[model samples]
Target: MNCADMLNNLDSSIDTLHTRTKLSEVILKKGISKKDELIEYLRAELSEAFDCRVGFWLQGSRKSHTLIKPVDKNSSYDIDVGVYLFFDAEDEGLSASEIKSTLKYALASYCEINDEPTLQDSKNACEGLKYSAFLTIDTPIYYIAHDNATPMLATDSGWVDSDPKAIQKWLTDAQDTDDKRALMKRIVRYLKAWINVKWNGTEHKKIPSLAINILVARHLKQFEREDDSFIHSTLSICEELEGFFKVENPLNGQDILTLTYEAEVFAHEKLTELKAACLEANDASELQKCLIFSRLFEHYFPQIELSAFNRISGLPVTVTVPELTINHYDKDDKHIRTLNINEVTVKKGESLTFSITNKAHFNQYCSAHWTVRNIGSQANDANDIGHKVVSSITESHQRGAAYTGSHTIECMIFNGATVVGANCIKVTVKPAFPVLRRKKIFKGFRR
Candidate 1:
């Protein structure tokens, strides 16, 4: 059916939303009343949060809260809601985290009966609130996953959301391409943060954690861009998750999903096999490791790697400096140029040098450069400049032949990168040796 048709169906659902039946302790009438009132209060408060800007309220709990079992007069109950903020630039363009911190104070200020606000203002981000088209959040206390959220209180539409398969099909379907994709993004975020209160034996009663939520949002966002194969999209999600969670797998680049009819089906069995295979696949490439771990991440996580709550880390600019040098210490291999110095051991400010020749490995008459970086340094941040070109001598083709230091020198040679086996050649400036000065004498001076 068309969106209009679907929307018409929703219209009927809306009518019956207010008309209620008693579900255990919750009177549907009273619940709806309470919900409406709460929404109004929220609308007003969120306006001031962004300095009088409008905020939106998307009701995931569009139905009345009905207890699964009967509730007594004084029993605790669960209530979950989703609220999106429409900022008014009050944050000076600060991050969503900063805005969240600000909004907390705003909510407290408004809800305050006294010096303190009643309940802590909750700010959850499903994705890109910092640079978002609009701020968004998806919250549910009722269900573990968005695909299985408690259906809205509607008459014809019933309550639960449509099938995941249906949603997937609709996105790829030529008819509802746009709408379906829009929804897929929403689904990713929701699944990422879904309580999954009963997942693989997790018992988090509160909302979903930050990392999982980000994971879901990211993967779903990826799935939205897919038009080729569902399995590919799913597998890509796994790959991303492996990187995201820093998980190691054996199937990094392998398309294990193609081995099965579909991913969702073999997710469980494939997980066991892949895990075992990863264990046995000793000395596998990082790609192979990523392959195995991606699948595991795919099965467990529904979100992406980055979000407002848990921004994904940027890629590490890795540069390796091979320990390549001429063995000046070895009598047989010693050369006139590029003499290997002592092993490098000093702080950054302390300088070190190596003897080099006119035909040094790092020297270039034309196009060669050296790189230096602090790789694998625990104290260095990822943003630290890990690669640098120390010196490049274009004058190597001249008559100058380097007898002491080399003609070509590369600074990046200091980057601490080795190819598996410790192929390192350490270099440090040697202590200067004193040479005795002899007085000028003629050839017959011995007489």
Candidate 2:
């Protein structure tokens, strides 16, 4: 079986997991309304307390429509709302620590009004007023120049150049269509889920969701199968991280992986393990694939009943199998290179010749029958199952790499009506020139 149906079912199952963690429309609407009310209240309080003009806007996952509850049920949803203070030539003496202190103090009264005891402060944001057990809003202060230059965030150490909304715009504008955009979100959510499950309740440093989003957007590619799209992105990311464990903020070109050297190595090893497991799942049988997914995703994926295809039939006495030789040819039919049967990856639009040589000496009138089977969305579109015999005299059978997927060709030696020897070869056909890079703006952040 191609396992497409099972994979589609797995996709739906993943959506179910996402739905469980994703905030509902009604809840989000209420959260937004409450958030806006708090923003207005804080705007008034800060302006009166600090004697400076300020602006408020939503940012982060909420604004980008990529918010999801953390995999750990104990963790609350974090919504980031930026508070910008426009500065002129006269406000040069203001300090980041002082501004953060004043903001936290002002939030104390609001938290009191909301029946919260105290306000919490982080390196970049002040956390205040939990709307519920599952939600908390974070206010990160920023100072904007009079000429409307890049905003500087009030960090614990000092003011640092930051534009919280730039990432949202970069992520949203990267995709061209709504479907592509939705798929991007799904991909990001899946990666987040993996990380959430990995480091839950552990002392190890957790990978930030921002880094995951950047990597997903960087490596995302659309495939005919949803499973293929996900596996390819994951494998591509693993390959990249294997060489170097670093990711840059798309807008300002800053390395976002702020983990200790030990932590970085740990995360890299774990991600490499994830890549290996994903590849194993891709090549596994249907039932085994479901189990691997369950373990990889913490049982969030569902199990589906799948049927396996019998690629071979008829049993015979032990005998030496026939030898199959494969050669790749260019457009002009010139011999380019011979492919190893164990690792044959052909490029689409190229021509390949498969010849069968009888290695076992059998004194009988034997005929060589060839069968080609194509598997994947591309093959399915062509409606080619390739069960019938294509060549009976089998000096060589030439075929074009017309599709991009894993396909197989088999040669069976038949003595009258009984099977004698058989050999099968699996070939992987890839696109002529695979798309490994995105827009030029994103090029610097990759390497």
Candidate 3:
């Protein structure tokens, strides 16, 4: 089916897996110091003005770890800024609208979503809240909301945060090259590299919200350290994710976030390949991981010998686990086929019985093709008549024995435009009994 469906199915099939808390202690990360400096200054002003300890902060990609993203390998751009406010979820009963009105009153003419308010909601209702002021670049101090915690800005209203314009300006600022965003991106890259160098040595599960990003960044660096042949596959993943995120060329070429993801996913594969690359790796830890990956590749990517089925015994045909995904639509178009007659041979007057199944029916549950081909005589022989696939058989059927001599019969299958296989059956017809039925217990006849 689809990814969503697969996820749903998997969830239903397995017991709930308890996800341990990933980040035990929250550490304010680098890459947003400039933005943070301005915001913190504002928070101090507002807190002093309103007598509250609530602070305006940053989160998301930056808070998770790094600040400015890696330089765009292809070009340069501004950073993405997200703001957060620390507050208890349950301290107030004021409606979201009231908070927004208060924020607008405090910070007039700020850039904010007029059509909708930005408010972050949890499945569970929250307690104690602190709101943030929105700032247009022109008016960095214009406030928006107060006492609300969730801080993503929206067109109308949601969680209140710093003005989008103000944040965007800081993101584009060129003078402060060593600011938080750049530093964070570097830190994330280092973390990722560290993860790569120390996969088994350290447990990644203990890392922060953006620990995986570290993994991605490190893996990307690995692509640069190793062989050139893999450059494209890694590039393909980078481009693919870049396209997925709709990142610019410069941004895309500069980092390995997506490639690292794919690498980690196929971590077993890459690790195994790296291990086999050389026996001279000085690090025993790396060597051990290399061996682990090698074993994984051997186990998972084991060569699959895809082959067509040749038996016609009505026995259900199935491939092995991690089985081959095969299509038999060579020139012809079909996916699944059913067993049929005419080409199905039995001894003279011998009855043949066959059955069909719905084991692999997916959505839509369309139909299957059942045909009998008689390779009578030879290729293109006149006696060799072929029956085109006509109907979708749901169950089994018995066909009276054939009157013709032995012939090769095949039951072809199809699904949509793809062909599944052609199962062959050999039937040899015996000579018929004499038609004299005068109650004769003739010789060679069992009474």
Candidate 4:
């Protein structure tokens, strides 16, 4: 049931912006230099004209370390930069719209001289500068009164009481207080990757990354392995979202998941399906676990090769291990034809037999020790791992597919405990499709 190695491989596979640290050391060095220049220009222009002190800070995923690259290569990466204008007693009367307009004008001037990036009126909160086809920086305007007041964000209607830094602090503090290995950040990245694969286009309404960040932070837990931690956290959140699915902002206590009823229902259904898939994967063997995760995360998750798990470990390191190929047989003792070794599948409630062929000839007196390793929750609960070793000359092992899981069997040919040949085969047992029966109801009515 433990797929720790595969999970670790997946953790490293995701191409998040944080994973671009090495690349950022080069490319983002220029990006940051441009950002600094733009900031200096804005501060000089705004302070000279409006006669107010200006401050700036990074917010959103870039600051939280949960930023993921766009699933579509053509899409731009968004950087949220919070701009705070500290107004003196004289400039306190500036309206929210006026404050936003002043910021836009300054940004427009910078863009005009730069000649590389263009400006757009990203209504409501921020003014966006499309630095390049692949990148954008959003400047959300805010103001503080000299009398000491909370920061207010400029919106279409009016100024709103908010602080972008507070939200980031909440996430940072929560993560800092918890797992030191940054498991929370890893989980958030995984969920964001899932979101990108499931709903990244205009075809579907997107779930706010803020909501996911908050929900995951609230329900986060640490386990000995990342896979177990992820599954438990997902299940915890999905279970809590049973009645009214709402994710509140940790800093302000406001429902951040503001989605339409239909969209909300759709999201809940998808998350529920994800929870079920996680459970199913927990009950699967190593290879099956990889398949389940691959499907869950689409092309973003790695596809595992059978050769990775085709290792034999019984012989000594100095000894030259021999090779063997496995053959399958049905309950009728009939040869089950299979083109590949690991592609064997059987329906539950059926019995299958396995035999090995020693490609490297061993002594005739060599004993064939067959070992059956049953995996999955069902098998664990049954407490019947089939660890019972059978010694036979033919190297035949028979087992019933009583439980649905990915199970394996191994044959080691040993001459007085010194192994000569070894082989293992993975078998997937799945539930058989139910057969429906047609019954006669009324004369012409079908039930």
Q: What ranking emerges by TM-score with the best candidate at the front?
A: 2, 4, 1, 3
The TM-score, computed over Cα atoms with residue i paired to residue i, of candidate 4 is 0.62
Alpha carbon RMSD to native, model 4:
21.8
Q: What is the lDDT of candidate 3?
A: 0.31
lDDT of the candidates, in the order given = 0.29, 0.68, 0.31, 0.66
Tens digit of per-residue lDDT, candidate 4, span 1-447: 335554554464433222421123333455567778888988899888777788899888777877664554355556778888887422567677877888888888998899878998657778879866446788898888754677888877778878777787777777655553377887787788677756655365667778878878888978887778888888887787776588877666778777888888778778878888888766676665664664555434432343433342333443333344444455555666533464478877667756555434666677776556555556533333344344655655667777788877655566784555555667788886657788967777576
Q: 1-447 in candidate 3: lDDT tens per residue?
A: 111121112343221100000111111122133344435544554465444454443333434333221111121112233323243322444444443444434333211422222232221112111123211111111223354322333213343333433333433342244443333343343333323333433333222224344333323322222222122223433444433532221221322233344444554443334433322222223223222222222211111111223231232363111111111121122323333332432334445544444334422333333333332222112212222233453533333443455543333344553234433445554545546567856578566
Q: What is the descending lDDT order?
A: 2, 4, 3, 1
Count of backbone clashes for each model? 29, 1, 56, 0
Candidates in order, TM-scores: namely 0.25, 0.63, 0.23, 0.62
Instruction: Give the clashing residue pairs of candidate 4, or none.
Output: none
Residues 342-376 of candidate 1: C-alpha lDDT, one tens digit per residue: 24322222233332343343323323223221221
Q: In lDDT terms, how accurate is model 4?
A: 0.66
Error of 4 at 150 (Å): 1.7
Instruction: Give RMSD to native, each candidate.
Output: 25.6, 22.0, 24.8, 21.8
lDDT of 1 at 312: 15
